[model samples]
Target: MSAEHLDDIGARLAAARARVAAAEHDAHRAPGSARLLLATKTVPLDGVRSALLADAAARAGDPAAPAPVLVGENRVQELVAKAPHLADLAPEVHLIGPLQSNKVNQALGVAGCVETVDSVALAERLATRCAASGRVLDVLVQVNVSGEETKHGAHPDAAVRTALDVAALDGLRLRGFMTVGARSSDPARVRAGYRLLREIRDEVRDSGEPGAEGAIELSMGMSGDLELAVAEGATIVRVGSAVFGARPL
Candidate 1:
């Protein structure tokens, strides 16, 4: 990448971080409470590397910057392909897309966490794979709060039950709940969906069930709705275009 391109990536990352920090403050949440997860869906390897380098440079220059950088991939193939190349940067990678049962082994090979485990069957598959490999994988229950047929997640009503079942799995650690907010022009509608996820998260945490103790994170929102998500108690926001300047067509 050219120096100008690298500078552009750095600027975009800095802007995204600022947006996250500002959102946290506006919501009266502690600084750095809501972490940003760079969604590298179609980004090329150089672009991803540039973003990581920029993030690292920003944190090194400012000790008070938000927490360490996190990168999320929407495809197992992408994760498998890029993770090895980016291993030297030590980016905390999470599989944020729908994972197939057959691909569990490959997904676990690279992703340290799976954020879209939406079903007990899928959770079981992950657990079986983890058991054989002796690896404990972090997971979040993806809830379709919007009831969007196109979205991949457990229905909002079944989220708690799904979370409980996932928690019982031996090789998985229930980290929290994740949801893609309702796609609507009304911010209230979007915020309502995020708030519901938080409510479900609280219910699970309050249940005192085994493995529910650590299920406190709420990963919601994207570049557009991050403020709403943060206001609704999101601990992590997955951002793409806002940081990467739109994916390639």
Candidate 2:
């Protein structure tokens, strides 16, 4: 990255940290805590390195400050390319992208948790891999909460069924549901989208078919409107630009 790009990266990282801190303070604390995932899809390797370095520096100064929580990658290949650079950075690495059946093994190699377990085929693959590795994995049912025709999530009507199948597998723990809120800036639509995800999470818990005990976590919201999601019951917020600034094209 050019020096100018690096400077921009630093400023964006600082702003993101500030916003996350503010969000943490605004919401009523829930249970042990809410998870804040740093969406790092478009951030180049240099920027990621810079951000990680900054996180360490911040922690050295104030232990209470978060160290960019969990980092998520939308693509397995991108994550694989960047994984070595991030090996010592974050403890929890999430694959928030759509999972192709053929790529499940690659995702398993890098992602600590695959957040978009949308299909039974993919879930079964993950179950097999984790089983062979003698490890249990965490996953969320990605629901098409926005009802967008172009979105890659499972249809809202089918999400719970898929979640049931995924959870019943021996290797996967059905953590909860995740959704991308409607993109419109209109607050009402975003809230409604988040509410829909929450509603499904509640229904699945009530049905008791997912085979998980304890409260489910709703992983919704991004940098744009995470506060509203928290208001509606988001247990994990996936934020990117609000933390890292505009994505690098």
Candidate 3:
């Protein structure tokens, strides 16, 4: 990336972080309660590094800045392709897209977390892979709160049960829930979807089942509806276009 391009990315990243901070305040949550995860889909490796550098610079300048921004990719192939190059940065990479059963082993080799475990079968595959590798993988159950046919996640009605089952697997650690939110023009409708996710998370955490105590994260919200998500108690917001600009068509 050219110096100008890098500068633009840095500026955009700063703006995105500011938005998250403002949303957290508006929601009456602690200043840094909601974390930002950079969704790096279709972004080149250089651009990814630039964003990470920008976050590092922010932390170096302010003691209270959040830890290195988390990185998430929407494809196993992308995660496999970019992870090796980003290994030196020690980024916390997450597989945020659908995971094919055949690719579970490949995903385990790269991603530190899998945020799209939508089915018990998929979770079982991941567990078997992790056990063979002798490593426990952190994961979040993806809930289809919007009931969208296009989305891939556990149905809203079955999310809690799926989460509990995933938690029981030996090689996986349930870290709460994740959702894409409802796609709509009406803010209330969108916020309702996010709110439902929070309710499910709360229910799971209070269930007192083995391994349920640690399921506290709510990875909802994105560039467009981050504020609404924060208002609904999101613990992590995934931002992409607002930070990296629109991907090439």
Candidate 4:
């Protein structure tokens, strides 16, 4: 790794540690709640390898260990490329990017959680793959709360229906709802979007569906808005650059 890359990772790690500390001190929060899933999309395997090694070293002597490292990827190719070894290192491997029906089999090969189930066709494909594999795949419905055309998630109002449909699939477990907030300098919009997704999750829960417990996860956050996400009941935060450094060109 370049010296500059090391510096970038050091700074990001410090920031993540700081965020954890703040989250711990936030007494208004639940006793045991919310989790971080560092988004590793577009990041090389080496970067995650380095960060996990460092984290393990730092916690060697501590009695209360830090949370287990969780990794997320945004694309099928990347997940396929880096998952074999990482499967043992990371407790969870989430597919936090857009997924298509054609890629379900590949996704099933590596993913522990598919966090961006946005369509009926893709959901059915995932279930079929899971059934064939004799595995019950966990999944999250991606909600486009911001209504951005460029975004890949479904609209917030449609998230529940989509999630329930996926839950009904033979071998799929509707694990939760996830979303990527609109980018902004103020951060309020992003924060609001996180809250909105959380509220949507609760609504789905209150529906008394069979998959409610399995689908309680609300994954909404990245490096920039993770704090806001945690504050607003984000069970999974997919932080990329903030935990890992800038991607190599």
Candidate 5:
């Protein structure tokens, strides 16, 4: 890797950290209440490892750095390919892309959490596979708050019901809800999408559904709108380009 490339990555991570800090401060959230998940899709394994190393070094002096969490990947193949090479790092990997039924086992092989579960069928498959392995899988129901036909998430109106059903399944833990913001520069539009997810999260928490009453995570926001997401009560932010520069073509 070129020194310039790594430097670019470092600069991006520093900027991302600054944004997270500023957002947390503005929200009056306790330090580290929100966490950043470095999105690694399309970024090479070496790049991923370098980013983690940089992330660790950046917070080495700060005892209050955010809690340990997984790096997010959009493809199962990427997770499976890079997982062993990055094993010593012990990075928790979360699948943030839409998951197909055929890929459930492959995803479970590496990911600790599935943040883009859009349907009950996919959730049940994940639960069954986890049950067979005698392990529980953490998951977030993805809601299409943007209502864009291109998005892969349950509609907001149907999200609660879907979440309730997913929560009832065995061997799967419903951690919270996740959504992608509108693909616009407008902060108001982006905030609206995140706010919808938070609203759904609040409703699910009080819905008496199993696994819903506990601390439900809101995994919204991305490289572009994470600040807005934090202001809207996002617990986990999936940041990509901002931290890794643009993905390799």
Candidate 6:
């Protein structure tokens, strides 16, 4: 609620937007072609609101500014807690964290989209819940391009098969792929992961699998490697720390 805190968030959001804009231009993407899904994992609800307000204010003056349409959370608990109250901002709340079959109902209750769908079982669970609710949910299949054991996604080789499977589910709209780059200081390594994601997305799109028509989005990158991701044809970057400052320890 502090004015100073809100100002800090506004400034941070403005800077993040500038970086995304610059990256988009260098990548030769059309204006407003990409978006920054503020990864509001540990960020407070007020911080998210302030960032959206700042974006709205900027767009009110310049219509070309990148519109912030999504705010991502890592857990269903936080999403359910904040999504209803922040409906005014109109941003699609997404689950960017690992989703368990048991949490599908809770996640579907609040999330407009689930970006970290890593398994067929989870996808089917979501499809069932959506069917009961009479709603179709947008979902991005997560791929572990880095092959990290700790990451939650299908292996790179299995990504297309997984996406095709998920697409066939009636209640889930297959929206492309998402991945986490290797945690490394070498930019080349990170870019490789993003590149792999784009390649996979293209393969799936070309396969003409049942519901792969609109699987063009590549939800890659973060604060540390966003530019590299953009250079690799990322359509959406999940930036958090840069926009909201470091998370609380």
Candidate 6 lDDT tens digits, 30-71: 776678898988778888899888878877876555666578
> How much lDDT does each candidate structure score?
0.91, 0.78, 0.92, 0.77, 0.87, 0.87
Query: Where is model 4 poorest over a 10-residue stretch in terms of lDDT?
Result: 24-33
lDDT of 5: 0.87
Q: Candidates' TM-scores?
A: 0.97, 0.87, 0.98, 0.90, 0.95, 0.96
Residue-by-residue lDDT tens digits, candidate 2, 5-69: 66676566667556545665676653325567778897788777776676566667665655346
Residue-level lDDT tens digits of model 1 in 35-123? 88999999889989999998888889776778987999999999999998998999999999999887888898899889999999999
Q: How does residue 223 of candidate 2 score in lDDT? A: 79
TM-score of 6: 0.96
lDDT of 3 by residue, 113-207 (tens): 89999999999999988898789999999999998899889998999999999999998999999999888999999999999999999999999
Pairs of colliding residues, candidate 2 = none
RMSD of each: 1.1, 2.5, 1.0, 2.2, 1.4, 1.3
Each candidate's clash count: 0, 0, 0, 2, 1, 0
Measured by TM-score, how close is model 1 to the native structure?
A: 0.97
Regions of candidate 5 where Cα sits further than 4 Å from its true position: none
Tens-digit per-residue lDDT, 1-249, candidate 5: 577787778778878878988999999998787888988889877778888888778778888777754599898888889999989888888999988888888999899999998999888888888999999998999999988889989998899999999998899988999988898878898898898889999999988867788637999888878889999999998888887677667
Q: Candidate 4 residues 127-202, lDDT tens each?
A: 8778887999888888898887888888877887887777778888887898888877767888888888888888
lDDT-best of 4 and 6: 6
Error of 6 at 13 (Å): 0.9
Native-referenced Cα lDDT, model 2: 0.78
Point out where model 6 deviates above 4 Å: none
